[model samples]
Target: MKTRKEKTGFRIPDLSRAAGPISSIVAIAVGLMIGFIILLISNPARALEGFAWIIGGGINSAKDLGNVLYYATPIIMTGLSVAFAFRTSLFNIGASGQFIVGALGAVLVGVKCTFLGSFQWVVGLLAAMVFGAVWALIPGLLKAYNNVNEVISCIMTNYIGMYLVNWIVKSTVYHQLTNRSLPVANEANIPKLGLDKLFPGSSINGGFIIAVLICIFAYILLNKTTFGFELKACGYNRFASRYAGISEKRSIIMAMVISGAMAGIGGGLLYLAGSGKYINVEDVLAPEGFTGISVALLGMSHPIGTLFAGLFIAYITVGGSYMQLAGFVPEIIDIITATVIYFAAFALIMRNLLQRFRLRKGGERT
Candidate 1:
């Protein structure tokens, strides 16, 4: 019995996962480096000067910061819109259509109604939300009941919405009076929030505050509500959720409605912030909706993350213009942003590889 002896030892291997937000930041940095390198190959001197100019222009003053926030406002809303649907494993590819409908609804109310002051704004905002929700619901219902692919349906809807809004503007009294050729009414104009007084040249407005509040509210709704839990559960496993008595159809519809409402509110707020007197269907559709997908991914589908992503994108955009002014290609920012998105897609692959390596190492040690 005394001849037997045994010992036990343990080593604490790294148990932490890569910080997702930090990893995203690193990816962005890598993207920027690549962008700069590409520029260097073409024109080293201008590239260097352009980089400096971008940094300087983006943060040169408070007004610059305000402008970034201003641009961030709508994207934040649309990002939330996309993020909401993502939680239910649904891709809301129709945010562009919903956004247009929302703007059209709000503009119609804003111009046609004689209600002045705060009531006009409130009514207009509500109208936008209602219309936007309905617009999204069409595709949601189609996917739920008809088994139609939301992606295709949403894209078709986007085109239809654009044409419809354009026709409405042309035929309605809300048509622009400015040269008698313009298509939007002056009465529907969004009043400035005195940002002009604070920073005369900047387009910053109260909409920024509204965007932040909406983000906060969305975070709370998603994390602290029963409905949010249902949405998440359905997204995780629709079959399992259905077996557990969750109504898949209802969840799908609700997700789309909520998503559309967020986008609509964003549209309304953008107009209210003095971005435009009348909503231009084509102007708001393209980059706003497409960029939201990037924002949603970059933010990791979190409201706070979306806010930051929107700001980052706005920074690069505004900065890129400055770079162009300084004799470098402004498209540098676009390249960097696209590269970051591309790299972000590999995050899951990177995580799996790391896990496999860890497991293999553990097996050998044992």
Candidate 2:
């Protein structure tokens, strides 16, 4: 029977487990196609060259790869933040607020508490996590008890956090000349952990390792623990979880808190890179948080997938910068990123279509 089936035609592969990854790949391919079309319209003569750069430019040197890792670190944390909340059946738009608040807390410690010695950065990270958790807790509380929508509360908090940071920075750690927060203490910079030697002039640091470890930890927590199971159960059906004595309200609140803490740590990692970057007292919210949504969606809310998705975005960003050499402005990269994000939002639909196709194929074979 198997030989006869093979002689007739190739069998349709099982797509049940593979649907999510396959859809994500399709989304990426579509996004890239659209980006290439835009490039062709803008600069027909160099469109192919610019496209090549956008695809493989990040591998040109060790420094470029290192920079990709450096940039991926923070976004990975934020991606994990979004992914965690998503798994818990919650939307965490407040990641931006949590991130900025956490950054401020780290800065306050890094600047005012130099007496912490070599532990300044460590304390700063802890402060950032604490601040982020507290910031998220407000929305979690409102959502759990008052039946408030987290989206609205989160949006309000983003503006509040941005303005609050601006005001506080000017009062406490303001640098009059630069109009930004003061530089962190020398010891407050995250350790390079020999990444400087490995990357040769790249800003990569131990923070990348931290980000990777967190990803692994998150994967394990979500896949191997009873608590993780309960959180997911609540997400799938809160009333059912409650009937099972899972305390859905507690799970909801904890999920948001954990998500916020991750976002906060991301802010701390970015600012403490010791790369001479300082927090600007700007009116805009942190972009990393919003980008996290793209990463989570693209990764299908899988922790490991989110890590790779973050790296892919960073790789594309680095490649886009090189597009200038190919007669294309770097802003084209933004168009590409936006397009990818737009397509990523359709991953679920793609998955469903694939599953339906698989079912039809199975029925025919039977």
Candidate 3:
């Protein structure tokens, strides 16, 4: 046995050197096993088959892999959006709203404009990014100037945005308004990446390439840019950063704006890839934005990690839906995701325990 002080004195390196990877593996395994057990309780026969299908259907063909990547595109963007805000110590709970605004903006541009044939895509995407930034800036400015909590302000903005977009789509001049019924315009449609012709049934698009480039850009911005340093410093200590001549107000607003832009771009990618034209405002607020938070958390706020995290999530979502069709309830994926998040929350606690054990052994040897 060792004294309490001795047991608590282990080096940080000894505690976490191997624990990071180990914890991740453990977290994933435990989460999946728990999901399996839940499925077993719900329907054992389907459980096994569902598990098999999830693995087989998602990895059996090149096309399947393409679908996974397709789904991963938006997830990566949204994950970066959430991660960027986390670095600034801001919880942007309104990514959903910002995403909707971006979608609406993109659709409006895509439909109303007919400049260059190939250039229309760029214009629509740019419109989405700019509008999304402006939408998010409102909450950010309020937080910075009025001492409003971003979390609350963002949530309110989500509802307001939803209603406003719905009104615009249903009543504005852009409304289809045909003889009997109105439909979204054809020009506003995002063309498939020719994957439909090549693969025959895939929804993969150029958005995948854009997503990868954005991830690289985000990584560079966060790790290599002066703006990132200022944002991070403000997050760590606003007072200290201010004393150091960094403007907290500016950093906060800028951080949120960038975050909003990333999210907006994600929404544009989503719309351009599929989902046809903006059907309804309600359709815009899918759980992807909320799921982005999980991606950010699981990735530990690292850009590289976010890419993998997004892929993993996309795998489970697409694969999980297949599993549901096969027999097992799709909710199993939700259970697994929740379990993983729960375990992730305790990473610090586990590190402390491992440190204590290492210290005790070292003390005994001494």
Pick the winner on lDDT between candidates 2 and 3. 2
* Candidate 3 lDDT tens digits, 189-234: 5566576665456678778778888888888898899988999888
lDDT of 3 at 159: 79
RMSD of each: 7.3, 5.8, 4.6
Q: Report lDDT (Cα) of residue 44, candidate 3.
A: 75
lDDT of all predictions: 0.76, 0.88, 0.77
The candidate 3 region of ten consecutive residues with least summed lDDT is 177-186
Misplaced by over 4 Å in model 2 are 1-16, 356-366
Candidate that beats the other on lDDT, 1 or 2, i.e. the better one: 2
For residue 205, what is the lDDT in candidate 3?
A: 76
Indicate the worst ten consecutive residues by lDDT in candidate 1: 1-10
Error of 2 at 296 (Å): 0.9
Worst-scoring 10-residue span by lDDT in model 2? 1-10
**Over 4 Å off, model 1:** 1-18, 173-200, 281-284, 350-366
Q: Between which residue pairs do clashes occur in model 2?
A: none
Task: Point out the higher-scoring one by TM-score: 1 or 3.
Answer: 3
> What is the C-alpha lDDT profile of model 1 across 142-257, one tens digit per residue?
98899888889888888887778777766764435441113333445445567667765777877777788889988888889988888878777778889999998898888889
Of 1 and 3, the candidate ahead on lDDT is: 3
Rank candidates, lDDT, best first: 2, 3, 1
